[model samples]
Target: MSEVQKYTIADVASRNGRGGAPVWLIYKDSVYDVTSYIPEHPGGDVILEEAGKDCTKAFDDVDHSSDAVTVLKKYKIGEIVEEEKKYDANGKKKKRVVAAAPENSGNRSCMNKITCGLLG
Candidate 1:
């Protein structure tokens, strides 16, 4: 496969369908050029509302079907730059790691009670 194109937020924002430019938006840090798909969109002009912006939350709020998602993939032109990416290499959202509590102070008895409470 060809090397995927990389775009910065400014690059995506510039193609906002104004003055004959392409329409683009970001979802999960991946960029898409949806100008050609605009007319066929089931949501009509509603899709335009997200032009040149990150629309992941709005897209998920509607709970798009698998077919819709598959279609969306066809228009993917590239991805947001690495510094701006919210997902890992596998396309999973990077999980926020909570630091484990320090064990030095907690009594063994307390931990045992908590463990038993969970298992019991």
Candidate 2:
């Protein structure tokens, strides 16, 4: 069997529509290249707003249908690397680890909201 590829948050972040590379986003620890889907996204360019970052919360908030989730599988390129996992105060690993946005991306809180919602 072929081994599944794993990508670190940094690796995924670096590929965000730059140098002609596709944009990758993480959902439930799986990395997906949604570049092709961008133009066709029902929500328009909102998806691109979270490009190269984790979007689990935002995706779940929309309550995608089973068929929609199934469609997402086609874009699955890899899983998040182990080191990117985050832990809570009790040391249990969190289900979603929001990736750091690029330095020039304004408003860190907004990016956090895009990935994990307004817990802060």
Candidate 3:
């Protein structure tokens, strides 16, 4: 059986008003930055009002299509890490442990490599 990962959504909500780190809406391994879109959300204020808070319940209640899910995957926050067996120079597999860049760092490789080319 696959294990389920847990997040303290309620804890995040409680800290939101106190200016905590922006809470990301993660689904199917993709993280969405819903902070900027809170005020403009079509679902009304209450649903998105807790931008920096935990809104997993609210988000789960929404009606989104599979296509939307596919689109959301494109906004994935962190790089998908894969396990390697050996190191190579051309493929350059190293034992160095590289940490994922923090969210809200304004660095999105997908944006430049994927989004820009498709949108523009």
Give the winner by lDDT: 1
Per-residue lDDT of candidate 2, residues 13-112 (tens digit): 9768777878899887789999999888788888877888888888889999998898889999988877775544454447775798667655566667
Model 1 per-residue lDDT tens digits across residues 8-88: 999988888889988999998889989999889988978778888988989999999999889999999899988878888
lDDT of 1 at 17: 82
- Clashes by residue pair, model 1: none
> Per-prediction count of colliding residue pairs?
0, 0, 0
Q: List TM-score per model, in order.
A: 0.73, 0.67, 0.34
Residue-pair clash count for candidate 2: 0
Q: What TM-score quantifies how close candidate 1 is to the native fold? A: 0.73
Off by over 4 Å in 3: 1-20, 47-60, 66-75, 79-120
What does the lDDT come to for candidate 3? 0.46
lDDT of model 3, residue 56: 38
- Note the residue pairs that clash in candidate 2: none
lDDT of model 3, residue 106: 65
Between candidates 1 and 2, the one scoring higher on lDDT is 1
